[model samples]
Target: MMTDSADEKPTETVAERGMWGNFRRWLGRGEDDLQDRLFALDDAIAHHPSTAINYVLRGECYLQIGYNQLAERDFEQALELGRSALARSAWGFGAQVAQDRAVRGLRIARRR
Candidate 1:
């Protein structure tokens, strides 16, 4: 048996590739397809609520779709789940619209 090494890339099975192959192709297609992928991601998040990256990714998708409220909510959740810098950046962007204190807090946080 071969030992796993740090420099070795993980090999993906054909089944695993097939599962997400369409999604990879659809990413560059159009907004509608992208939205479909986002919805699927949201469903995945529902099943795995503890995954912080999912919230961050879905927050970005919400921003792209002009769902500012949902984006803000997801970003806050991500922040609570330990994604401080990214969540602060998202909050700063949203603050441009609402002028929330999150922008100020983000600057203060970055100073330290």
Candidate 2:
């Protein structure tokens, strides 16, 4: 019978503080150079291994640095993660977007 507003905010913010939080925070840090961005993304993935965007970003960093093979590996892994039930639960509504990003990355990676 307790209708307290104090308990409502946390239920809504769970996604924000989890996978979505890290991904959105990374995007909010605009104009960071590739190396710094890559390092941050690596750390993010180390903690949130199921987050698809981190994989995509790391793959992009590898691609930009002429490491096409590593880029391809990450891209492939991103796609796999995108399709997983665990990752999908974390993604919530962004699941399709994550898959789309991985597919696009793969296309670019395959051109080499």
Candidate 3:
């Protein structure tokens, strides 16, 4: 999640609620700008395919912008990566979060 205050300074400090806020701001912005952010996230995912945070963020963005197919793909990828991370660690919180995001994503995707 992220935020932009009255001064319009972007801040990446928000709980789950901020996800919607971020989505709204992105949606209201220009399409090219939003796509750039998406591409940046995509690049990050490509470099760190197993990162749960990156996957969740990208998937969430896609879902927000009505790209359910892409969202599903990101979510599924996140789930696989999360499971792998979970297996490789004794206590992996990020992996657990990613797994949960994937399940939620499936529910969101059901409408598509």
Candidate 4:
């Protein structure tokens, strides 16, 4: 039988070099950091492509990450989706929120 030592470092896979350093850097980011939030929002948008709110959320994430062009595109898409939903009367308050968020995101993106 073989036993692993506690002092031994685990094998690296994600990155051969500076993996722990990278992890430490990632951990140093604040709770409100948008980099991690962006990934979750990306998956949400992927699964719910027609959801206007997801687009608005992702747009805000992009805005926080300083990706102005991407933020603008997402905001525009959210606005379009919200408008269509309202036109069909399919979404009431939800569509209004999406439109409002998209408008705010667009304004900030354009300003940057």
Candidate 5:
């Protein structure tokens, strides 16, 4: 059995690799960190086509940076993925949250 320690690096390195760096960039608070994270996320999704968290995060990033169309697509994708996830887990909340977000994104698009 493996035991976690304070100094131990997390196994999910991709998630820890400066995701906020991209968010900061979107806010004009940092350098162009999105391209690299987006590329990595794209590759990860290609490898694991059923992953939904990536879609939600990408959608949020797109919205934050004013890419409404792209954000809508991502939010839609996230909703679908959230649905699938919900189907697989009886106690899942991600589906509801994703659905709410998608609805909000659609509203934003309508206002534009």
Candidate 6:
């Protein structure tokens, strides 16, 4: 028989924790490596379309690489997928007015 304890914590596998490690490493890599990592993240996103966090992560990478348009797109998609406050803040919009402006910007971009 097995017993469960309230103080026991669930364990995360290396694969589950690798994203952050990879992200940290990517931050210090050159442009080419960053691009390669971004491509890999895109592939991961393709396989996991419903994961909002993946979109946000990819958006961060895009922003770092000076791809503002793509980053905005990903942030907008993340917001649509219910990312809400985090996504808005990540795009540098923490206040309600800023969030509204972001929404308008997204709408304008979509219309073009």
lDDT by residue for model 3 over 5-105, one digit each (tens)?
67675645324325455445434446567676686567566656667767777787787789999888888888888888999999998789879988898
Kindly report which residue stretches of model 2 are placed more than 4 angstroms away from their true locations once superposed: 1-25, 28-32, 86-92
Q: Per-residue error at 86 for model 3, in Å?
A: 0.6
**Which parts of model 4 have CA positions greater than 4 angstroms off?**
1-33
Ranking by TM-score: 4, 2, 3, 5, 1, 6
Per-residue lDDT of candidate 6, residues 1-112 (tens digit): 2225667666433256466664564455576677766866676677667555556667667666667788788768766654454454655433344345446545544544
| Model 2 lDDT, full chain set | 0.72
Task: Give the TM-scores of the predictions, in the order they appear.
Answer: 0.48, 0.66, 0.65, 0.68, 0.59, 0.48
Predicted candidate 4 versus true structure: per-residue lDDT over 1-112, tens digit per residue: 2225777666432233343443343333455766665765675566568879878877877776799999999999999999988998854788999999999999999999
Estimate the lDDT of model 6: 0.60
Best by TM-score: 4
TM-score computed on alpha carbons, candidate 3: 0.65
- Model with the higher lDDT, candidate 4 or 6: 4
Cα shift from native, residue 17, model 2 (Å): 10
- Model 6 ranges off by over 4 Å: 1-32, 83-112
Which 10-residue window of candidate 5 scores lowest in summed lDDT?
22-31
Residue 28 displacement in candidate 4 (angstroms):
16
Model 1 residue runs over 4 Å out of place are 1-29, 83-112
Sorted by lDDT (best first), the order is 4, 3, 2, 5, 6, 1
Q: What's the number of clashes in each of the models?
A: 0, 0, 0, 0, 0, 0
Between candidates 1 and 5, the one scoring higher on lDDT is 5
Query: Model 1 Cα displacement at 58 (Å)?
Result: 0.9
- Residues 14-70 of candidate 1 have per-residue lDDT tens digits of 344453563464255467677776865666577657545556566666666667677
C-alpha RMSD in Å of predicted model 4 compared with the true structure: 9.9
Estimate, for each residue in 1-112, the C-alpha lDDT of model 5 and write its tens digit: 2227778854434344455643343334233766655665675566556767667666666766788888778777877887888899888776677667777775775466
